[model samples]
Target chain A: MKPARAAWLFLAPALLVLGVFFLLPVLGALGLSFTDYDLYALADLHRLRFVALGNYWALLHRPAFWAALGHTFYFVAVGVPLSLAASLGAALLLASPLARCRAFFRTALFAPVVTTAVAMAVVWRYLFNTQYGWANHVLGAIGIHPVDWLGDPHWAMPTIILFAVWKNFGYNMIILLAGLQAIPRELYEAARLDGASAWRQFRHISLPLLGPTLLMVTILTVSGYFQLFAEPYVMTEGGPLESTTSVLYLMYEDGFKWWNLGTAAAEAFLLFLVMFAATLALLRWPRRSGA
Target chain B: MMPRLARALVNGLLLGGALVALFPLAWMLAVSCMPPGTANTLPPPLWPAHPTLDNYRQLFAHAGMWRYLGNSFLISGAITLLSLTCNLLAGYAFAKLRFAGRERLFRSLLGLLVVPAQVAMLPLFLLFKYTGLVDSYAGVVLPGAATVLGIFLVRQYAQGLPDALLEAARIDGASELRIFTTIVLPLLRPVIATLAILTFLAAWNDFMWPLIELTGQDHYTLPLGLAAMAREHTAGTESLMAGSVLTVLPVLLLFLSMQKYYLEGLLLGGVKG
Candidate 1:
């Protein structure tokens, strides 16, 4: 057999697997988004109607869709920066000369990266329990009233946010540490010699050098935060009133729970559009700023 | 003089950060050891007055955690094996094979990484439900078989393979698959190990897809089982910690043992991919 033919055979298996499993499903989702195909439609394709963008239109008008979008945006808007700040702080600390037990600290901080999110959420859920939780017990010691962490709608998302930051800040911290290491030491030395304060040195030297890494981390974290399913699924089950119903959670509910496959497909596409556009915007903004 | 004060303050901050980072995990261990309801007091006890393994016994006895652990092991193991084979072959082939449309195909596959796996997931569930794979191990294992990241990693390593060796093998009348198994697989050992750890870690940590697909509690993996136990015992603190411990231990061990390879994979996936 010719080597070219053999090579084709070798590649064929993987391509076929991806084609049938990945590509077809992705395309199917796109088609499903346009039709009013659902569980009822699943029972018989004859029930399916070609509705064009009617699913998207209905999703826009649906209050649930807006609430899901708000929850997701709230998650991304608040969660991303808070996570980045915690990551940046941890990374900066790890990068600092004065920080002792650097190895121990880095490992401890990054420990959550390997943890199952379902398990992490479970641990956090117990930790936030109003009666049995240590969070309230500690507050009680400080003479503060026991705040219902997961029971209150206003506090539920914040608790989830805090849980997410604790679980994930370490992943970005490691990446940022690498980014910090790549920044030339001579730049910091020059700043220090010029009598720049530590904060000033950070602003001028560190932040500018970290621009690309910052952008990359933000894009990754934003897109990651967009698929906020497991946290809410485990901790809130989409809420104390759907306060934590992320786009992915809503998609899961509409698709799996309600069997509204068509509407769920539309929701998934809308989420994809938002994430794709957001990522592109972030990627382009830096180049534009540089220009 | 100023630097000394700054150093002291920084030391204090470092100490505070370490406690914050490590406290929850430490507290988890402590609380698991405490008797039920003992840790739920006005001032939370730092150490359990009477440490016990009763929670673990309870987990194994009634909570059915052992079955979930078995599921986690079996599913993750199957995924790791298949992912290594498929990803290594495809990754290596993409890196060095003389195939038509190789670059374009690989590029498109890589581009799919952007469309969050969650996006296709809604329809993917319906797709699986039709196939009778839902509520079965195949549902969890099939989609994980071939991954873009796995292919990318192997390709990066495989691009470094010597062309002359493959040519010599071909001259000896060896088929492509034979050469790959004997010559290429040996050379790709480092990447295979790295990819194995990564694939296993991901499979073990997977939550959403399995949660949706594994409708039967009988098939719950560690994460799913943990979630179920948490819901079942919403007020049971000590038992929940034990459940968390069971869920996290395998991953923690794998990570600690193979930190170098995993860290290398992380930086490689980040900077290069």
Candidate 2:
């Protein structure tokens, strides 16, 4: 056989799988969004109505959708900064001149990143138990009252956020460490010669130098944070009266639990649009402001 | 000037941070061995006073953990093997084959990377639902069989192989499949190992898809099993910890053994860059 014919044969199986399974469903989702497909529509196609923009409109005006969106935004607003600060702090400490057992500490901090989220969340659920939880035990040591973490609506989302920060910050910590290492030692030396204090030197030499790395980390974190599902699902089940219901969590419940396929597809697309816009804004803001 | 006592305090703070980070996992193991009500005591013992394997025995006996363990192994192992075969072949073809539309197709696949896997997940569920593949292994397995990133990783690795060797094989009337299996397969061992470990871990830890697809408890994987077990109101702390231990141990060991490949794949995935 000619190599051209042979090559197509080689590519056929994978390409077919990707085209049918991946590309088709993505387009199917776009098509499904235009219809009024729901649990009834699942049983029969005749029940499905072609309702363009109706789902989007309902999502905008509906209190539940707005509440889910608000919950997602609340998560992003609180979770991202805490994660970034923890990562940057770990990276800074690891990059310190007097730091010893550098490799060991690096490994220790990153141990959580490789953990299966499902398993860790299981572990965390126990750790946040209202009565026997170690978190409360530690609080007890400090003479503080035990807080119902995953149980109370007010505390549930924040608890998930804490678990997320612990799970993820290490991954970015490594990236930021690499970013720190790439900065020339001479810049620190130069700053020292000018008698710059530690904080000022960090502001001038470290932050300025890490602009690109910081941007990438923030974008990746924001995207990851916005897709929050597994954390809330196994942790709180969008719980304490849906206070922890993220957009993806809402999408999951609407799509799978309720079988509202059309609305769920809209949720998925809206999430995609939001994330896409967030990334673009992140990339644009730094450049426009000349950060 | 800072005194020696001040320096000691800083080190103490760092040590405390490390301990706090690790204590949950450490305590999980400790509580798993404790007797039924031991961990729930007022003062909360640091070590189990009456350490026993009774909770583990109970988890395996009543909760059917072994079934979930088997489900996890079967799904993850199958995904790893399938991903290796499909990705390797497609990657090699993209790297070495002379075909029309190859670059365009591959480029488009790369474009799909920006769209999070979650975007397709919602629709994919409906697609599976219509096929009656929902609540089946096929449902859990089909969508992930050939990933764009997996193909891209293999292609990038395969691009560097010398053409002269393949040319000689072709001249000898060696079929492309023969060249792939007999020659390229052995050369691509390192990446295959890397991707296999990575894929297996990913499949094993996979939450959203398997949880969505496997509606019945009989088909639940370890993660799913553990999640359900954690929510059982009557479940003792010991049994839950045992479940956590069972779920986490495999991936933890895999990661520790092959940190290099995991990190390499991480950097390649654009998450690190």
B1-273 in candidate 1: lDDT tens per residue? 387887787667767777776777788888888888787775567798999999889889887788999999999999999878778878878877787788898889888888888766767777887877889998888888888888889998899999999989989999888999999999988887789899999999998888888999889998988887767656477888888888888998899888878877887787642
- What is the per-residue lDDT of model 1 for residues A1-291, given as tens digits with 9 covering 90 to 100? 776677677676677767767888889899989988777887887898999999999999999889999999988999999999999998898898877788877887788889878877887887788986778887888899988999999999999989988889888898999999899889989988999988998998899889878888999999999988899888988889988898888888888888888889999999999999999898899788882
lDDT of 2 by residue, A25-53 (tens): 88888888888899898888899899999
lDDT of 2 by residue, B1-273 (tens): 255654565456556657767777788789889998787887767799888999889888888988999999988888888777788888899999998888897888788877877777767877787888888887888777887888888898899899999999999999989999999999988788778887988898899878888999988999998888766667877788888888888888898888878766765654423
- Pairs with backbone N, CA or C atoms under 3 Å apart (clashes), candidate 1: none
Off by over 4 Å in 2: A1-3, A184-201, B1-14, B164-173, B271-273
Clash count for each candidate, listed in order shown:
0, 0
lDDT values for all models:
0.85, 0.85
Best-matching candidate per TM-score: 1
Choose the strongest candidate by DockQ: 1
lDDT of 1: 0.85
